[model samples]
Target: MAGPSRFVVHVPFTAPDRAEARQYARMLARVLGRLPEVDPAEATVSPEDDQSVHSRLFCDRLLSGGHRCALRAEHEAPCAVVESDR
Candidate 1:
């Protein structure tokens, strides 16, 4: 038996700035997360010129029982799982 294989998909798009780009990435992640195979919490963004460097869009902190935080990165509030509108 083997575990599920994982991979990364790079989506290149132009944004007015880094902040806007991050916002777009987070939005895209949330929408895509509706699918069973998409893990939006693990989404990240990087500049087109320097793809090697990356910035996480979510806090994604490891919680008890193997769960992860669902808040934005560097959030001040306590770690929690945010419910999405279905």
Candidate 2:
């Protein structure tokens, strides 16, 4: 059997301090959880950074819709979609 399809969603934000970064990450996590195509329980949010954020989302099915939603949610985020080759 093959593994599930994977996606990397990059979320970028600029914050003046660590406190703001922490707060923003939590808020964004909620939004990502609410995405119709995402299974929040199966998603993994990586460490937050002062300049960017990223998450690894897994699904049994295709994820183009989910990718599009993430990009649309934050138009300024420098995000890209790449399908797993493995």
lDDT for residue 2 in candidate 2, whole number 0-100: 92
| TM-score, one value per model | 0.86, 0.39
Model 2, CA-based lDDT: 0.48
- Deviation from native of the Cα of residue 71 in model 1, angstroms: 0.8
List candidate 2 segments past 4 Å from native: 1-3, 36-86
Q: Write the per-residue lDDT of candidate 2 for residues 1-86, one digit (tens) a residue.
A: 99677685756677776456545655665466666555443444445542244443322233456653333232354555533222
RMSD of each: 1.8, 11.9
Candidate 1 deviates by what RMSD? 1.8
State which candidate has the highest lDDT: 1
Query: For each candidate, what is the lDDT?
Result: 0.91, 0.48
Q: Model 2 — TM-score against the truth?
A: 0.39
Off by over 4 Å in 1: 84-86
**The candidate that achieves the highest TM-score relative to the unseen native structure:** 1
Across residues 1-86, which tens digit of lDDT does each residue of candidate 1 receive?
99899889998999999999999999899989888888899899999999998999999999987878988888899999877665
